[model samples]
Target: MTRSPFTRRTVLASSAVLASSTALAACGGGGDEGGDTAEKIENPDENINPEGLPIVEEEITISFMSRRSNASAEDWNEVAAAQTTQELTNIEVDWGLVNEEAAIERRNLLLTSGDYPEVFYRTGVPSGDIAKYGEQGTFIPLNDLIEKYMPNLTARMEEYPALRTGLTFPDGNIYSLPGIYDPTSLGLRYQTKFWIRQDWLDQFGMATPETLEEYQAYLEEVAASIEGSIPLGGQDMGSILTSLYGTFGLANHGNDAGLIDLDADGKVRYFPASEEYRDLLSFLAGLYSKGLLQQDIFATDAAAFSANGTEGLLGSCGVQTPSGYFGKEGDNYVALKPLVRNAGDEPAWHAVRSELSSIGNFVMTDKSEHPIEIARWMDFWFGEEGAKLFFLGVEGESYEEVDGRDELIPELLEDKTVDEALKPYVLYLGGWYPGWATDDWFRGVETSEQSTEGSKVVEPYALKEVWPAFTFTAEESQQITTIGNDISKYAEESLAAFVTGDRSLDEWDDHVATFEQIGLADFVAAHQTAYERRS
Candidate 1:
């Protein structure tokens, strides 16, 4: 496959175009007022082919706007996925690719100027805007199109009802499509796990920790025995919270801003304001006081954490894979099952990800001339054949079947990582595209033996029922945004202070009270409404 060269100059040029269009964007934008009716172009019956390749008898080009990461080809025409799709579908796309960083700004400019492209692909339109634009006529609804033309997507919706519930707005219209992952894929089921130094455990003749008390004892032993070692290496504040708080029954999910989850009764509860959260904080503070935890955790990032592990200074850490930290030394680490408060008690909470992403990946604008053909083209990505093409690129060239399994060419992996080698062929690595990601394909092609084994260790403890992506009414969305932002900021700051012993636990009541004053109840109520609507 031929690859197109991408340069820093290309990125700067795209940013320049977005910067120049800001004035026009400021002139007009979405508001309470309804938008203009979408212009309709009658379908040419003779040119349409409903179910198979070559959607249209004659090739027709339509405008498509999408974001491109730095790893992607400079020209979409040269991308193997784009080239092969065009060849098979006979639907030429006039690509309007923008840098990933500037895509949202450019999209907003086009939307406000009333000159948006015919389609938006993988631009990650926010749920609020999906509802806002769908209510207005700016984004044409795809309910009928999906039911009539997209068999693959319709079948998926039937299988996973959450896809329909999450994508549908308050008006009962579907305006966007999402990238769906196989529900059983362990890699996508959970995000992070508690990884510990197996070498240290072996040297000390200690077993894997199972309970909160045992875990703390292990950390204290490591701190006392290993010189200059951080018994529990620091991660980002959110990751640290996510890795530990579940022992106290708080479901953090690694999203500091959206720290709300359903309780045992399936009701919306703000975790940061709960008694369980206070207990978790006190536990962390105790660890900090003993020097068992990293002192500069608030400032520590992934790079710093990895450095500690690489230097053999971390006894344990919370991360997806140790390869990201210790490189070839990752085999010395082992993933631990979620700890419990006491032996024989089950772990109450485990982090999970929604199969359907929160952000919409594909949408049709009012200006499209061939809605049916476009819907069919978009739906192709959901099917098995098209999914393989989009994810693995053209067969035999980018990947080949060996022993009844698809694998990348061995020569491509000699010097470059799997990601680096596939940049010239595949459009996306594992995400940011609207399609169905299967466990077989992802595990076979994208993951390593180490990652797969780590996933297996923690899969049994994962949450069986997770909250699906919820869609709020536009009014509810605005209210949540206005109030939730302040709550999130204040909560994060308070958490850091309390953990570091800068703030005494006696003032915990005052901190909880402040959340109430910041409209925490209202913020939670809006989420509850959305959750109930999904039911």
Candidate 2:
């Protein structure tokens, strides 16, 4: 294989190379001995020469990897290479960016082969993976190191129980320092928002459809049958159709703990077997036959979806997120209002879901020679200052103070696009919508006037309920993980069959049964258990 000079993450499940193999193997142990790997300090007064850190002039390389979407590791890619390094810690970094596909392969090869770097950057192993490796003696336990060094990181972990919980594994020993951000984000960015094209509605002289039945009537007319614009556009990954289920008052479609919600009193039943799901199917099926359904709904990516939303192609369609749909037109789409009930029936929308992380499952490798150093750097990124540097660029250059606040001053770029002056300098937060991570990251990156001028605006029609069933527990995690993998595959297949009209609602019973047979109950139980535990 031609290995990209990027992250080499190939999954190799071999033994983690450890120093004491015979004794450890004889003892039949793979859990943390919970002992510090640092040389034991017989007396802190004598042995703890904790006075100084390595100076910037005394250079050492930190070879870390990220599962990089961009693929190439440029010279300026190192987090510490920016001006803030000299300003804060005075540490110079050598960048070794790696590709993710071979991440596991290299990780296994290094740990088993025993030629790992002094510091493993972006090892690409999960917490469970950490536990497995730590138990194997491939990873050093971080309990004492965290206590002795990393006071700033320790302060935040002590403050947030969740942070500590995330870092510490099954045996009460810390493995990897978590890539922490604010536990509570401003709000859930990944949400379902139903968007209607103001232009299409205006062309038809139609008032915004409020109820599901009314919307259906509109969609049917627009379905290219009765003579309006194409009423729907479909994409598989996007959950616009999921809104059909949401209209029936189901919150997160994927659930465990119990599919049957206990009311303020109490109740029990399964969701897939519910009448709401049935109605959703029947209505969608009807739309499909009428040619009102989106043909490419199952295949479209986010870019395609955004094109439709921005281009005003349909009368109304499914979009769980409103931000992209709203701007450009600027308050044109009545995005935040409640949809009316279908016919004379009740109107219900899914509870607003929160707690979606920017990245799923940040990982660490077992080849860390300086776990404390690595953890310290990661913890700083989670803290107030590090968060600022990562999100916003150096102060004054990117932004200015205004009315007791830091906000971006609008600057036209060379391309003549209207972007904040700071945007080019500040490292982008992958795909996360702006103002996420640290609100403090905004400080001095912009002027108050500019910040206030460019403040976020949401459609008035957005949903208004909190669905707290977000986080999953360890036991529940095992089940959810299993089901999630299967569910995605099954969902794709089932949705395809339905969209093609090869399968009808007549076979809905069989479909539900199939899902259950594939461990739907276990999945639901896990999510429910996690929800209750976290709550």
Best by lDDT: 1
Count of clashes, each model: 0, 40
**Model 1: pairs clashing at backbone N, Cα or C within 3 Å:** none
User: What's the TM for model 1?
Assistant: 0.89
- Cα lDDT, all candidates: 0.75, 0.47
**Please, what are the lDDT tens digits per residue for candidate 2 over residues 1-535?**
1111111111011111222342343243222322332433212323222423322234334455433323222334443324564345434444343455665676555555555543444444543345555566656666776687666667766764555544555566665554433433222322445556555567667777877666776676565443434576634534555455446654432221223443323233345455565666666767777777766666677676566655555555555333343246423443423455555554554433322222122333344433444444544555555556655655565555578755544452344322233344554423222122534443321212222222222223223433322333233344455455555566557666665676776777767776666666665665555445444
Compose the digit string of candidate 1's lDDT tens values, residues 1-535: 2111322343345445644553354345433222232223234357889789988889989789988777677787787888899999998998799988898899877888777877888888877777766665668888888888899999988998767866788788988987776776766655566788888888888899988788888898899899999988756766667776667788743332267777777788898898888998998899999998899988878788878888888888777777755776767888788888789988644656667755577888877777888889988888888888777787887889999988778887788876777777777653567888765565332145665577788777666666556677666665676666667777788888999998888787777777776777878999888767776
Off by over 4 Å in 2: 1-61, 71-73, 76-83, 100-131, 134-192, 221-228, 234-237, 241-245, 252-275, 317-331, 338-353, 356-366, 402-405, 416-424, 427-484, 521-535
